[model samples]
Target chain A: MIQGISIYEILTVTTVLFFIGVYGFLTRKNLISMLISVELILNASVVNFVVINKYLYPDMLQGAVYAIFIIAVAAAETALAISIIINLYRQINSVEVKDTEVMKH
Target chain B: MDLSTFLLMRHEIVLLVVILLLIIGEVFIAESKKSSMVHLAVFLFGIHTLIGFLSIDYGSLFGGMFHTNALIQFLKNVLNIGVLILLLQSGDWLQEKIIRVNRGVEFFILLFSSLLGMYFMISAGDFLMFYLGLELSTLPVAALAAYDITKRISSESGIKLILSAALASGVSLFGISMLYATTGSIYFTEISYVITADNLTVLAFILFFTGLAFKISLVPFHFWTADVYEGAPISIASYLSVISKGAAVFILMILLFTVLKPLMHIWENMVYIIAIVTMFIGNLFALRQQNMKRFLAFSSIAQAGFILLGLITGDQLGTATVVYFLLIYIFSNLAAFGVVQAISLETGKEQMKDYEGLYRTNPNLSLIMMLALFSLAGIPPVAGFFGKFFLFTAAASKGYYLLVFLAVVNVTISLYYYLLVVRAMFLRKSDNAIPYFKSKVYMRLGLLITAIGILVIGIYSPIYDYIYELSRNLL
Candidate 1:
């Protein structure tokens, strides 16, 4: 039989993972890598949502519904984003964020 | 439903109808006559805005998932006027660029969808309703920010916006879930009743604030703003700056003053810290910007910082100040961007140096720009001054004297950069300056109306009194 850990530990771990993902996103030089890091950050939140829902307000199902919606939206967002990235790569032949930093001071 | 119920729903229904018609019209309109569809959509939307103002009775629906009090109705009208000016100014640019044609109709649809979302978000009484309304407003604007698909930077802007927004939304959702876990309900009014300075509730409030702060592009969450603003087209930037930010501020005010009042001790300190950092960082970045769009981007961010002053107040006076300031800010910022849009259309140049001796070529546009910049800098004889005055007074009344003092100093720093643009336009001379160009009648008329709004609102005090009454009804 598996013994479940405490809810506080779950929340703490999820929060830490989110901050790590945010760090990577801010520090990453490549746009695609940053996007991946963002995905991690979003996933961390989904985990927190599921955990919170499991622990509290299980009757409402609002948290679970919200998680589903977020996942669907995230998928759609990534699909559009990746295709745009591919197009940009086709034209510029590079995906490094530094190479695309032309419109700034 | 009774006549009163029907009357209460009119403003939202009108906007919803206009959005549907525009979407359907986009499908059927022939390629050659598509512009006619755009025109018709604008006409319908304008009429919808007039109807929104004509609305007097206030009501809620779907258990307060949506509402339209006098304050919200007035704001919707303000948003309509802002969008109308943006549409008029952007027409020439959109028409000239072949790549951006069909997207114009989609742009309008997405814009109204976001506006509709904002309408509900401002009046949302429950956390679930608020979250839904927020997503409705956010998702489309992210798409609109990257509407110029042909450009690499445009796509980049879209990706950045969506990614950040998703992260912010998810974090905020987690926070909301925590709130539910703590309070045993998701309704904001219920949570407000239960919430206190408890650790769980404070953490939840912080997370929620972070999400909304990203929307407003406040400091620490503002990393994405300049890049996205610089990358997107000018029209989209104008929308992002004026309409989207205005709507977010509206919801923030509502949430802080009403739903989250119990969490004040925790979030008030957070807002105080965020406000100071946002003002400082935004001003520092704006000072170094060369791209006209990026400059405005940071400037708007700093303005967002100042608006946080009202949020820190947590009172009806704070709400009134916010509405009044946003009303004035809409006129000033959009006017400044209108002049920039008009100039960029003729010359395809958007640098400050490119604007050298602009006064010599087109004195009218330059003068309009000067007034706009002055207003943005919170100078006398313009609306921005009055806006800031009310905001500062609101903050001071709450005994936030330190934030008020720092905001005043930040205002001084802001004046320097706004005047820098004026100097570039009027004092400097470039040998290769283009000859004076004629503006489209719509562009000129928009600028004239904005200038008048700035002047009249500053010189007159009645605007404040009227918005105060509206805020009283709102609360």
Candidate 2:
């Protein structure tokens, strides 16, 4: 445990954040809020990569590089999500998840 | 990399060059001449598919980040063939878009770009490359799903697809991070060397499997499929149902048989239960579907379950059967969707009730639909029967008798629903039946090729032998 901070503690925090993000994603109805929840989930993974790289495999920078790639991908994903939300809003004047169920049985 | 090593990536390079040429043509060509771009794309992809078969070099690049071999070549060529058929069947849709929205170039561009991603994904030797290629392949497909901007369902499908895809990938990335933590490497070979059946690693494996199950539209993760298929354009829907799902299954098989081989005892049980649930749920849901797209969606889900039968064996015969099934599935599913597309384009009707007495008006199209549906139901003498037979044989080889029995029951349940559509088309009579309409030359040719493929692929023994040989070398 470096400086009294253990890897277990960090992983615990990230796991909590990940589940909270999942809860928000399932409960929330707004498109933008769901996107935010997705972002939180992605960020939790990013945190996992950085913490794991620093503590366990400091000899190699591969995890750090992978984390960077994840961040870039999350950015692109967010852009696409926002554009889709805007398109949905234009169609029905609302971005609620329930409003998008026009293809129901 | 050496020059010879670079030559091994010829399929991807050719695809990249074609994409560039399409972009240049989009800018320089006048509005009226743009339809020729579709022809160019098809010609180039055909050449690409032929080249893939000819160039069979086995090698790895970037310290095992990417690998290429005869099996990968075969899979890439299969995808190229699927895409070429998609292009052929999409001519009418493309002409409509060119005349109305003027976005035809963008459609082909997005498709080829997504195909490029699949090429990288099938060849990826490491988790990082796999993740990157996955995102690259999936994002443009969301854009393509929303191609019909005026349709509310189209944009809504885009939203659901991208959001769910993001969540799945995030969960999978977390799993990858855990695997990296435990194994100390992201490359498949390195991971395989150190992987063990510990609790944490097992959990990571399940998480990763869930992500891929979403891609393959397995039971629990398949909520997005029906809606998306119903909303997206028919051409894109077929692409998603066949090409994307096939690529995912291929990569998943590779990862399971190679990187995660050590944890087979755990995954085999998980897959056994999932397969049972997936097959039952898919067929039960398909039985009630009124929309053709939704019906096909559930049917494809059941097909994914059948593919899992082969996955459970994790042997050469298993792999060969899965590949063979997917080849037959590509032709069968596309033929079904092609007929639906032609009918929908002509009449703008998508409901099963509207298809009553179709045989009376459009005998040829209805006949094709019946044959395709019969194949899908695993009737004898069609490609799907042979595909399912081989899959069950592979599973039974592994002593999975109960699972095979359950699968047989599910196949019976599925046949009822498949014949429901056939009954509606051939047996029922309606006063307002769809008129006989001739499709474009390209659509007819596309449908003809897939129809012939469906008819003859089952009787061919050499193809199965060749697939077995390819699967033997996949590892």
Candidate 3:
């Protein structure tokens, strides 16, 4: 384990951040807000990977490498999400969740 | 380091080459002949599928990051077949003036990349590889979902898919980190050795299951399905429903049966409840859908539920049955979707009311639709019946008789809604029914293949036997 910060403390802080990200996902009105919330969700896991790796297995680089991959993938996902949101804006002129209702019955 | 070792990765390597070929072909092809790219892509993919049936070594590679066995190779072939049929069915639609006039080849490249991702996913030997495969598979399809660039609904579907996908990825990653923290290893083989069913691991498993459940559209995570299907183009909708869901289910089952076997007691109960809820919710909601695409989306969810029956066994029976059922599912679902695409292409009608008196005007297409739906509904003498039968037998063998009974009930409920479509096409009459029109060669060929698959695979017993033999290595 890390010498200074307890593992529980790191995990506790991450747990809160994870829930905050989820809360933003549920409460966000605009697509951009939702997108940002998703980034937060992704980064929470990134933090968990790096912190857990540092605390538990400081010798191995596996968790650190996984964190890198997660970051790269989350970036790609955000780029696609933003492009699609822009496409939605082009056709509807609004990004609100309620405004994106061209699909339902 | 040796040349012989590369034999294990032939499927992925050849697919990568095909993707690069398409990209290069795109640049050289004349702008006026861009639509011909569809023909070239379909032809090249057909070769890839054919090559997939060839034999390859069963082993792990890349320090156990990549793994393949007979079962994984066979599933890859099944997915390749599904994608090939998808390309065939999409050929006509892609060439239409309303879509794909300029960017015709992007659809194929994106889809192939996604398929490449699935190939890695189902064959992954460790958590990190699995996560990378999952993301690669999902991101390209989000782009494809929004392929109909002119339509607001298409882009809306893309957004919904990516958002939910991002959340699912985050949730699964959290689960994986916890798992790594506990076991201090990411390799499936190693983790399985040291893993215990503690509370933290249980919580992690639940999160991981939820993430995959989103991909499979199981119950609470299924909210994005119908809306996305309704909004995306017909081809992308079918791709999501079949190829994508099949890959997710395949990987979920592999992880549960192999990597998480120690936690079977906890998860079987979870699977038991999920199977019932997913089946009921998917069927009941499907009954109300008027749009053909939306109807298929719910039906696919129900099919994913049926797949869970096989999963609960956590044995070779579960593995074999799931793979066998997915093979039949790919053919049956594609046939259904191919018919929908053909009709939607000829005329702009997508509602059930438009299908009234369909038999009177287009008897052949109606017959294909009937066959596809009957297979989907698990009627007698079709591949779907056998698929569901094996799944129930797998569940029943494990003495989950109550779960088996509930699944039977769900099958009966599903039959009702599937027959509803048949009733509209045959029993009801409308003056404005879709007029008889011929499909292009590719579309006809696609439907014909699925129709033949639906017929021949049911009575053929050897294929199921072969799958059972291959799946024996899993548990």
Over B366-451, each residue of candidate 2 has an lDDT whose tens digit, in order, gives 98898899888899989899999999999999999999999999999999999999999999999999988899988998899889
Listed in order, the DockQ scores are: 0.44, 0.84, 0.82
For residue B30, give model 2's deviation from the true position in Å: 0.7
Off by over 4 Å in 2: none
Summarize candidate 1's per-residue lDDT along B120-235 as a digit string, tens digits.
77767777668777878887877777777778788778767777887787678767766767787766667667777788888888887888899899998898898888778888
CA shift of A70, model 1, Å:
2.9
Q: How far does residue B111 in candidate 2 sit from its true spot (Å)?
A: 0.8
- In Å, residue B75's CA in model 3 sits off its true spot by 0.3
Clashing pairs in 1: none
Q: TM-score of every model?
A: 0.93, 0.98, 0.98
Task: Give the backbone clash total of model 2.
Answer: 0
**Candidate 1 local Cα displacement, residue B390, angstroms:** 1.4
Candidate 3 to truth, TM: 0.98
Q: Looking at model 2 chain B, report the run of 10 residues with the lowest lDDT sum.
A: B93-102
Q: Is candidate 1 or candidate 2 better by TM-score?
A: 2
Residue pairs in clash, model 2: none
lDDT of 1 at B150: 77
- Clashes (candidate 3): 0
